[model samples]
Target chain A: MIQLTDIQRDFQVGDQQVHALRDINLQVAAGEYISIMGPSGSGKSTLLNMIGLLDQPTAGHYQLDGQDVTTLSDEQQARTRREKIGFVFQFFHLVPRLTAAQNIALPLVLAGMSEKERNKKVTQALTQMGIADRAEHRPDQLSGGQRQRVAIARATVIGPAVLLADEPTGNLDSASGIEVVKILEQLNTNGLTLLVVTHDEALGKRARRRIHMKDGLIEHDTLQNHPSLANP
Target chain B: MKTRDATRFAFDALRGYRTRTLLMLLAMSIGVASVLVLTSLGEAARRYVTGEFASLGTNLIIVLPGKSETTGGGSPNLLGGTTRDLTLNDALAVSRSSLINHMAPLIIGSAPVSVRNLQRDVMVVGTTSSLLDVRQWHLGKGQFLPETDIDRASFVTVLGSTLKQELFGAKNALGEWVRIGDRRFRVVGIMAAQGRSFDIDVENVAFVPVASAQMLFNTQSLFRILLDTRSRESIPRAIEHIRRTLRERHQGEEDVTIITQDAVLATFDKILRALTLTVAGIAAISLAVAGILIMNVMLVAVSQRTTEIGLLKALGAPRRQIIRLIMTEAALLSSMGAGLGLLVGQIGSNLIGYFYPALPLGAPWWAFVAAIGVALGTGLLFSLLPARRAAQLDPVQALARR
Candidate 1:
């Protein structure tokens, strides 16, 4: 569950203040599938980043899982982010030097998990992502789809409560994009909360609940009539 | 992160740029090696000078005819500053102490000597038979001058080996009469070849009886009186007894200056030691330069790895962990450099020792320790700014830099 009450974010550029987010209020229950769609500079990505705990609101209150996360210290924010949230960037920011398995094992390693448990978790993540054979390969050695899969594995390896995907299939071909969208939908059907921000209309229409934004404000938030394809 | 993981991460970064890593290592090692080599050379020079002084003579003391001008902390002024005359009788009084082994009354002058056909200017040292013991010079042939009395003039002369060869040309110089300073004297002995020492060449000098020397040089004052004490412990006692006896003999006037060989050696030792430390300090500057180079290289490395740092932060690494990782890399770099430097410096010192075995050129263990310590310290200290920069980078801004 997530709640943002009157969250505002500002950036100062050359003696001018630019408001990136303003007067935003939102609430989401557990196990929700949401898509945020907008043109560039509409602050859709900014909203997703706020929910992901990467950027702090200049003036607002944010509560996640009953804790007021906006008041948390930087360290506490990092801990909360580590424990309950996962982020998938459009760039698939895999450490170029680490193999796929090592990349997936990074969060666990940062958590000081023992080597045996880390290996077990990483192996399981590799198998679940269907890229167990690519575990030994570096990011440069993998295809676009495989790299995205590794990034997804890295994100979900901590078993976080919410998965935030910023243009998850933006760089992939249609076939691979469909494959990734299906995988995200499958995870959502199994009760993982998913919030995706995208410019792809096809991918945006796939979500049952869609939110449209423009000029640092949410233009629309609505639920369309659709039964769960995953359950069907 | 665990220490082992930190180390591995550091090694990975270093391994990514092998050429840059090698260059940094080279710079650090060269700095440390120079410190070690220069300090060793300083120490070797000190020991060499000390050793040279040790070989001059053993437990010997000199009685000069003048008071020492120093305020008790300078070298013994031997040949100058005398206010009163010291005669052979004064030498006799100092030789009568129980701790005195023997005394050689010395009157040095230089004049021309000639045989029937050969002529050369030669240094003339006037001493008694005790010269053989006091100077530690051995006769190459025949006998030295005999001791009858300080005032007795025996027209017998002793020739050094070179002087003998100059006058007699391989013929026997003993019992040969040579004209020296307008007086004809018989050569009683030939000295061995002794190269320059104490500004006197025993091989180029001729010896004669003390009274003969006084008559020839036309002076009554003795130049110096060389005394060998009975034991090392008795030197202080001998000095006290000579001062007392000479003061009594000279009507209670302490005109003669007495100096033990230890004092002259100690003065040189102190001066050379100070010189050595100054040179070592000059060498230590290179280490600081190396430290600056480390800072420069580390600054570049941080910029190059900005994205990686941002990623690590995103993965939940703390700011302190980022700093630790950079510092760990610096420490590893410097430690390896220090190890290589130790090897190079010891090899350089051994080469110097091999070329000139007289200098015991062992770099003091402290020099080795200091070089290594300074190398590691500078490495860590220099990387602080770069590490801070890496830690302060905003994860979003850093990643956006591409």
Candidate 2:
């Protein structure tokens, strides 16, 4: 579970001030699937970065599992990010020199997991993501879909409670993107809170909760009432 | 990261840029080679000069005349002045002291000597029987002139080893008649060869009685007075006594200059040491240039690998680890250069010795250590700017780079 209240972010560009986010308030319970849809420059990525603890808001109160994460130092923020949040980037930012298994092992390694434990978790994650055979391939050697699957495996290898995907399918084709979206939906079904930031309407409709943004403000927040997927 | 991991990372980076690493290594190799070869030349020259001076015989003193005023008030050449007329009486006065072991009043000139049809220029030295002891000369074939020969103004002459070789070829030179400046003199002995000194070979000279030389050269003035002390420890005191006695003999003029073998050797050492240091100093400039080259290469590498640095940082590598990675790359380049330089310098030293046997070409073990230290220090010093730049880069900005 996570909560953000009265979050504000500002940037100084030469002599002018730019407001990136203003009076943002949001909350998400555990195991929810949410989609944030916005046009370019609508502050969706910035808000996602704040939620992922990758950037700090100028003024805000952030509660993660009832602890004030806003006042934590940079190192402590990184520790919390490593322990509770997994990030999936649109470009599949896997280290070029490392194989898929090594990339998947990174988050666990950062969490100070022993080598044997890291290897075991990486194997399970690779198998779960259906990329076990591609584990020995580097990012450059894999297809776009396979690379994104590896990145997702790397993100969730440490078993974080929340997955924040920023346009995870933006670089993939329709078929590969559909496969990635299905994988993310399956993880959400397995009790991981999933928040995806994207501009695609079709992808936005797939989430249980959808939020649309315009001009740095949330335009709508909608929850689908269909029970067929809930039982499926 | 641990030290082992950092070292492994550095080695991998170096392997990735093998050509650039080799270029930097070549630069440092040239720097070290210049230092080794130039300093070795200076060492050889010093040794050669010292050996030549020592060959002049130890504990000996030579007194030369002081400068005089020329017609236009310019200073006269001290050595070119007329002989100071030191006599056998002065020589006897110095010899009477317990410190004096042997003494000789020398008169020297050059003439052409001939035997049969062979003729060559030869130096003629005139002195008492004590000249043999003072000059450390020994007879190789016949007897030296006796004390009785000096009083008799003996026409008997001693041929130098080279002089005999020149005048008689392989024939026996003893008891043979040689024509010295139109006067026939019988060679009574042949002195053993004493190699070259001050460009003149002592083995190419002939020795005769001082009274006979006075009659032959038509001069009563002595060229110099040579003396040997009874013991090396007593030579300094004996020199002072001789200086005092000579000043009195010369009417308190103090016009004579006394030079000892030790003083000459000391001056030679000082000059050589300065030359060696000067050469080594000049070579250090090349080393500095090599350091600059290393810095330039490291900066280029940092720029080229910005994304790599960003990736490492994102992977939880600390700032210090990044710095160690870059610095280790630099050290690896320079140390390889130093190793190659040592090999090149050793081969060069031996090549030079093959051409000149008198010159010993060698590098002490400390030279190798110092060269390696200089290389490593240069690498660390030059790597600072680039390593710091790499460490301070923002991960977002770096990752955004292509």
TM-score of each: 0.85, 0.76
Q: Where is model 1 chain B poorest over a 10-residue stretch in terms of lDDT?
A: B73-82
Cα lDDT of model 2 by residue, B1-402, tens digit:
445545555776776687887888889998877767777777778778887777667877765454232444344444344447666566677678889877777878998888878888888888888877776666788977658634347787998888898888789888889888767788988887766665346689888888778877888767877777877898789889988887888776555666777887899889987887787778767877888898999999999888777655544455666787899888878888878877777778888998888786665454566666777788789999999999887665565454
Query: Which regions of candidate 1 fall more than 4 Å away from where they truly are?
Result: A175-192, A224-232, B70-82, B102-216
Worst 10 residues of 1 chain A by lDDT: A223-232
For A69-172, candidate 1 gives per-residue lDDT tens digits of: 98887777777877788878778888877899988988887777777898999999999889999999999999988998998888889899899998999889
Task: State candidate 2's TM-score.
Answer: 0.76
Show the colliding residue pairs in model 2.
none
Report RMSD for candidate 1: 4.5
How does model 1 score on DockQ? 0.44
lDDT (10s digit) by residue, model 2, range A143-232: 999999998998888788999898988889999998999999999999999999998878888888988887667788888876234322
lDDT of each model, Cα atoms only? 0.85, 0.79
Enumerate the candidates' DockQ scores in order: 0.44, 0.21
Strongest candidate by lDDT: 1
Best of the candidates, DockQ: 1
